[model samples]
Target: MKTQVCIIGGGPSGLMLSQLLHLKGIDTVVLEKRSREYVLSRIRAGVLEHGFAELMREAQCGERMDREGEIHEGFYIAHDGVLDRVDLHKYSGGSSVVVYGQTELTRDLYEARDKMNGVVIHNAEDVTPHDLTSDKPYVTYRKGDEVIRIDCDFVIGADGFHGVSRKSIPRDAITEYEKVYPFGWLGVLSRTKPVSPELIYAKHPRGFALCSLRSQVLSRYYIQVPLTDTVEDWSDDAFWAELKRRLPEEVSARLETGPSIEKSIAPLRSFVAEPMRYGNLFLAGDAAHIVPPTGARGLNSAASDIYYLYHAMVDHYINGSDEGLENYSAKALARVWKAQRFSWWMTTLLHTFPDRIPYDQKLQQTDLEYLFSSEKALGSLAENYVGLPF
Candidate 1:
């Protein structure tokens, strides 16, 4: 089968790109290795940036989200026994974030796309990228051991960090920028109620802790810990004790930690690959970059990648203009790098550093004090936290 764009991986970026292009009367095909149920159920980042919410509605994927998505006006930052809350809507000119998980967005997009007359081949095994310089670029994959080829004018890799597209670039010229932190986050979903009214980002002597909510019913929380610590090893008692210690005293007393089934221990990291595009193949979302979960950047960055690529693809097809595609890498990198820096900044400020000497800790404390004291510094943090529109 032939299409204008062949998108690999049925995650948010790939699915959303297919829907958007379909809306524009552009023909595209999506190939996913996993089942539809698996794609929609895997848990990931929530909290849609202001721009992302606008586009979701524009793309006609927001009907259910509008009904269920929790509205977050801002978040709180705590340090050195100091408390300050920046109302995000107050700064972003009334724009706000939606506390909806990435999995929900994927479900919305996939169902929306499937309902359209568009084509997506799930369980597509043996997929391979081919014929870059020709009139058609394609992927060869299998369906129950039957190999078939999908031909397209352009290809987009929205698979993720471990997918095939990132490896397609020549090893020598490919420059990978990365930083792996000493800590990891143990994220938990509890049947218990949230301790606070809004999200709390607290920096304690123990480590960083986050208190966020999925709804009035489900509470999502994360605690900084060593990457080696297994979720299995973290018994109910151990988890609550650690939480009680790291959480603010006010919330600590009230937090009703209860049974929870969904728990994940993800490694702390900040990584970005240069030139999201190489030849006829383009990379989007985690395929191009990753950020430490501290900033809640991964999902938003993925959305931003597709937003850039859609216009670039439109330009190529409509006006015979290669400029958009040619410059796609440069344009997308601007926002990606911004996020990389911001994610790194958030990670450094929130987490305790084992690498720091006594003098270094003092220096960091001095800087942290200045962050809360200086209006410019606080506003900068506010801007980064609320998000920068690309």
Candidate 2:
């Protein structure tokens, strides 16, 4: 097969880019290692930055999102037995975030692709890119013992952190930076009314707990646990008990509990790879960088990369300009590092670090105090939360 771009990974990043590029009359193909059902089953963060929502609309995939997704102007930070609010709209020049599940967003992208008869090959195996540095690059995948190859002008590595795209690059050519947190977040998805209309981020001596919602009736909650803890260690009753203990009394009093629809533990980590571009292969999303869910920057960061790549590809194909393509890495990295800092700061500020010294604890406490007291501090948080300009 021949195409203008070959995208690996049918996740949101890869699909969004394929859809966007195709709308501009560019041809592309998407390869996914997992079936569509398996991809939809994975529960992920639902918070969508303002910029991401706009991008979805630009891709003509935001109709359902705009109709069903909740727009949140503020969120609560629960500390000291009180729920303090961070006014995102007031602080970030009236900007707000949308509460839309990543799974649903991916579904929308998939449907959009299907409507246009876009090429998305699922259950592809042993997908590999060849001659990345050469003018002509191609990708191959195995399907039922038969190997099929796609010849394209460029390749996209959106498969994820463990994907073959980034790994295909020479180790010496890429610089990796990573920091693994000592704890993980055990999250539960329940079919119950959310405890709050807006999301609540709780910080207690017990640990950090978050109250989020995918919709009015589907609530997603998380609690900090040791890295060693697994799903088996926390029953529904036990998880609810620990979560209630962390929240303020009034908030917990109105909390609703039910059987968990899904449960998993995800360790906190921050990672980034230098020069997201390697010849014809451009890395986007988790294949290049990741941030802890604390600030909800993971998927939004990927959206920014797609935004840059889409315009860059357009410039190259239609306008005969290489400026956007020439500076994709440096521009994407600048915003990526800011997201890293925000995620790291939020994780440090709210999470109970078991090994933290007393001085560090005091500093954390002071940080929270200062955040609520100073409008400038709140403005900074709101700006990052709604997302910086793409």
Candidate 3:
């Protein structure tokens, strides 16, 4: 089989890319290694930057999100036993973020793809791309005992960090930069009302915690933990108790505790791969870069990569211009580094490092105090939190 483009993933990035390309009269095929059920079961970040929302609208997939997602204009930060709010709308030129779960967004994209009769093969095994540098590029995978080959003019690797796409790049051609934090985030999803009207990021002597929500009725919360800790190490009661201990007394007093519907521990890290394109094969989304979720950039950043790639491919095919395609790497990486810097800065500003000495702690406190005291500092945080321009 042959097509204009072969997308090697069925996640939001690949699906959205396929949907956009279809609107441009471009034919594409998508491959997924996991079952559709497994793909939708994974939970992820919910915050959507304004540009992402607009993209969803363009894909004709934003009706559900616009109807159900919450618009958050600001968030709170608890430090030194007090709660302070950062006005995102005030600092972001009236821009606000939408709180829509990644699961729902993926579902919407899937529905849109189905309505358009887009081709997506699931449960593909041993997926691999070949002859990337050659004029002709093809991808192969197995279904049971049969081998299927798809020849295409372009291969898109939206399969994520663990997928074969990024790894397929020759080691010498890729320069990888990564920083793994010594701790992880312990997150819980429950059906209780959130403790605050908006998300609250708390910094205490014990650790850092965030109070967030997927909807008015579905609450999501997290607390920083050591790398050695596991979900089994903390029961529901223990997790609630610890979360309350770190929150401001007033907020804690109003907190409602309940059994967690889901609990997991996620390691935090910042990683980026240079030169997103390698000959006929291109990387997008998690396949190219990953940021810590502190600033809610993990998925939004992926959306930006898609934005650049979709436009680039369109320009090349329709306008007879190769400039966008040639510049995809430099353009995407420029935004990628800015987001990495923001996420790293937020993580350092809010999280307590176990290895920090007394002086370091004092410095952290001073930074927090300065942030709250200076309008300029708060404005900077708000601008980044609402997201930078694409």
Candidate 4:
């Protein structure tokens, strides 16, 4: 098979890119290692930055999101038993985030792709990209016993962190930066009404806790835990107890409890691979960078990458310009670094480090106190939380 672009990975980023390019009359193909059912089954962050929400609309995949996704104008932050609200709508020039699960977003993108009859091959194995440094590039993968090769002008590595896309780049050419946290987030999804009207991020003397929701009736909550903790170690009752302890009294008083439908622990890490491009192979999303989930920037950052790459492709194909394509790495990394900064700062502010000295704790407390006391500090958090410009 031959195409203008071959996208390795059918996740939201790759699929979204393909759909956008398809609308522009650009021919492309998608390669996925997993079945469609498996991809849709994975649960992920639901918070959508303003720009990403707009991108979904532009992709013609926003009908369901617009109708069902909740719009959050503000979120609460609790420390020292005090709850403070960050007014994102007020501080962000009327911009707000949409709460729509990543799973649902992928479903919408997949539906649109099917309707358009876009080429997306599932269960593709041993995917590899060759001649990426040359003007002409191609991708190959095995499906069952047959080997399929796709010749394309460009290859997009959206296969994520563990995938082969980034690995394909020469080790000496890419500089990697990473910091793995000592703790993890133990989260539980339950079928119960959320305790608060908005999400609450609490930093208690014990640990950090987050109260988020998928819908009014579907509550998703998390609390910081030791890396040694396992899902088997946490029962529904014990998880609820721990969550309530970390939350403010008033907020915890209204909390509803139920059997957890889904439970898991996710480690926190901040990682970035410099120069998100090598030859005709461009990296997007998790394949290029990863942020700790504290700032909810993982998926949003990926959306920014999609924006840059899509415009670059359009410029190259339609306007006959190579500038966008040439500058893709430098431009994408500039924003990626800013996001990394924000996520790292937020993680430091909210999480309790092991062997943390008293002075550090005081500083963390002082920072929260300053944020609540100063409108400027709150504004900065609001602006970054809603998302910076694309």
Best by TM-score: 2
Please identify model 3 stretches exceeding 4 Å from their true place. Answer: none
Model 2 steric clash pairs: none
- Please write out the lDDT profile of model 3 over residues 145-233, one tens digit for every residue: 99999999999999998999999999999999999998999999999998987999999889999999988889999999999999999
- TM for every model, in the order presented, reads 0.96, 0.99, 0.99, 0.99
Instruction: Give the per-residue lDDT of model 2 (tens digit) for 33-79.
Output: 99999999989998999999999999999999999999999999999
- Top-scoring candidate (lDDT): 2
lDDT of 1 by residue, 140-207 (tens): 88897688988888989888998887887778747898889998989888877777767888888888
Full ranking by lDDT? 2, 4, 3, 1
Measured with C-alpha atoms, the lDDT of residue 151 in candidate 3 is 96
By summed lDDT, which 10 consecutive residues of candidate 2 come out lowest? 38-47
| Per-model tally of clashing residue pairs | 1, 0, 0, 0
Off by over 4 Å in 4: none
TM-score for predicted model 3 compared with the true structure: 0.99
